[model samples]
Target: MAEWINVKDIADGAKFYAGAAIRIMPTPCGLEEGNFIPENGLVYLISDNASDKSYFNCVCLSAGEEGNVICRLERKGNYVLGSEIKRMFESELQEAFISKSIEIAVI
Candidate 1:
């Protein structure tokens, strides 16, 4: 049998790193440069699931922050939703990362 692992440990593995925290500065949905709501924001991380190797999408989800905008990409069934994946890219629009997941392997 496979080694049993705690969900917290598994979730902790998926970290969504952002440039800055939402609490540091409060900005509107547009021209904010990050995808996460302050206080109750979504975790955001940049993955290589973009068309090009330089661009990435910001995933959202309903999870608390372990720190900053990084959280575990909650896996459900056999698929994971963008919202559950705590990771966002540097953008001014919050909807830019909507319905998209980084196709790059999590290093």
Candidate 2:
């Protein structure tokens, strides 16, 4: 059984969003200087099953803070309408995240 991490645990601002939670592909590096590799795991909901998967998206504001990493929405935050995922704005992503609709992974 895989563990489900609450968004509120790592990013303090995520509980405000709705859909919720993610499994991790753990990494041991710092996400700084625009350095991120998507080879790591995605922020996906186990409840959402489809031919094309949906994943939460976030921009790391600060990763140096222990236990409480800071993040905002990605410019193209993961937005799904019906079976299609769309490219949305960062603030829109923030809304989704704040409403507890999304969860972020630890870097």
Q: Which stretches of candidate 1 lie over 4 Å from their true place?
A: 1-38, 63-107
Q: Model 1 clash pairs? A: 33-91, 37-41, 44-87, 44-88, 45-87, 45-88, 49-103, 58-88, 60-83, 61-83
Off by over 4 Å in 2: 1-18, 29-38, 46-99, 103-107
| Predictions in order: lDDT | 0.33, 0.31
Could you give candidate 1's per-residue lDDT for residues 13-72 as a string of tens digits? Answer: 333333211211123754354534563335344333334333333333334543232323
lDDT per residue (tens digit) for residues 2-99 in model 2: 34433323342222222433333323342332323243433433232233343433323223322332232221234332211212312211211122
Indicate the TM-score of model 2.
Answer: 0.20
> Evaluated with lDDT, which candidate comes out highest?
1
